[model samples]
Target: MDLQQMRYVVAVAETASFTRAAERCHVVQSALSHQVARLEKELGARLFERTSRRVRLTAAGEAFLPAARQALEAAERARAEVAAASGEIRGRLTVGSIPTVTAVDLPAVLRDYRGRYPQVRISLRAGSSERLVDMVRDGTLDAAFLGVPPGFRIQGVHDRELAHGQHVAVVAPDHPLAAEHEVDLRHLAEEAFVDFADGSAARAQSDQAFAAAGLRREVAFEVSGVELMARMVRHGLGVALLPATFAAELHGLRCVPITNGPVRVERLVWSRFTPSPAASAFLALLGVGAPPTAE
Candidate 1:
């Protein structure tokens, strides 16, 4: 019924726990819950279905949440416009990235963004590309630099490509294949491979590339972290398919471009819910004058 209550509803829905939502909103749990209850009563609709282990939105809550978020975003934009007139901007700007973030020089980007808008609090999270995409889609992240597999589609989110590079093979510097400028993916098919775990963007690309080449790989070791993968390859545990940027600078490892391999592309992705002022400002730095339309 009110902005405060609507925010309470959204927080609960997002965190899925009244207590956690209260902490995030910086309010007492009882106060937050009471406001939500009052709003539900006024609307004659149950906004959330509560359980011992979780808090989920009801059908009515799901229907109202998007509108509620839009309302909040509009109000924030109005405030931001006023602040812009006064040459000041301040708020939390959460961004997500995948492990081995090769798309953007995040450190450089953050340094510049801070120099420009010191009042804005920058929150960064790193995870698998798929998980980061999910977070951006769910409004948990305002924007993200994603390293998605080649030909992967960005659905339900507005995105802009930041960088693209081909996948390359990595092995110990002394490995016989290290002397080659380019290697066919099929040549590595029978080699002991160090692979990323399934469900990851990198793993999916490797899987697809091998399938396309009509080759099967023997994954001798599985790792989900880039640092571990590089270390494994450096010690000659197994060969790996990696993004060129990721493999290029590692010590004791040699990177060879694949003759015909999956491409690794980086994209800047954001939800269509509505852009926060900080998010829009960051996009502007990336040459996007305005946020793209929702899909």
Candidate 2:
């Protein structure tokens, strides 16, 4: 009839004495008898035989005992599972990130997350910053890594700055500028530049920097992926200005720091109310520490 009723039936069957069963159930013997009587009536069968000396199960009661016990066990297991899911972290989390973070640091972050919550499934998607932000806004992704654009607007998103790193000049190893320890904007003003797509955060920041320096540069090529831009730079197509993470990772392309002033910061962002425990757990792993906090 109900979980409590099933539990009552199980206790009565196990103990075989109304007074003892009532004690086990933490109820008075009269109340236990009334509920058991109600269940037997509901099922249209006698569940117990009573004698002055002892109590025992009827044939129907024996047949129903295992079923009632199993039902109670199943209900308890369901409750435990739901409670665990609510309080303990375990589920699939869809994460989106820009090309630079995905290529450079995300592997370590994900590996640590996997080690911590092995039951939490992680689905990672890499895209341009704009696309990843759109995915988070549209509920397609639980969280993401993004380079927050200057004056960027999002209705219900929250972000935390994860790390600060410089934008470096990446060029072919054999290129003359690659030999320079650091590059100034004035030197690259006349050279062709490999750029992130026009609307991207990196491109926007780079444009602002060039504008501040009164330097006009040509976009010799455009690619969405920072890694691709670096590879193109390696082929001597043109030079690129990308996040230091990507530059540090590109073995074939030399990364020369650009230090006119302060370097840009990268951030991890997500919806203010992401609906996944796995997402929350991963953010917790980020844990409000210094730059590149995953470790």
User: What lDDT would each prediction earn against the true structure?
Assistant: 0.84, 0.75
Using alpha carbons, what is the TM-score of model 1? Answer: 0.72
Q: What lDDT score is found at residue 99 in candidate 1?
A: 69
- For model 1, where is the 10-residue window of minimal lDDT? 286-295
lDDT of 1 by residue, 21-86 (tens): 999999999999999989998999998999898889999999999999988866866887677668
Q: After superposing candidate 1, which stretches have Cα over 4 Å from the reference?
A: 1-82, 292-295
Residue ranges of candidate 2 with Cα displaced over 4 Å: 1-88, 102-104, 149-151, 288-295
- The digit string of per-residue lDDT tens for model 2 on 251-289 reads 877878886722556677676552455666777777732
Per-candidate TM-scores read 0.72, 0.65
lDDT score of residue 44 within candidate 1: 95
Best by TM-score: 1
Report the lDDT of model 1 for residue 192. 96
The candidate that wins on lDDT is 1
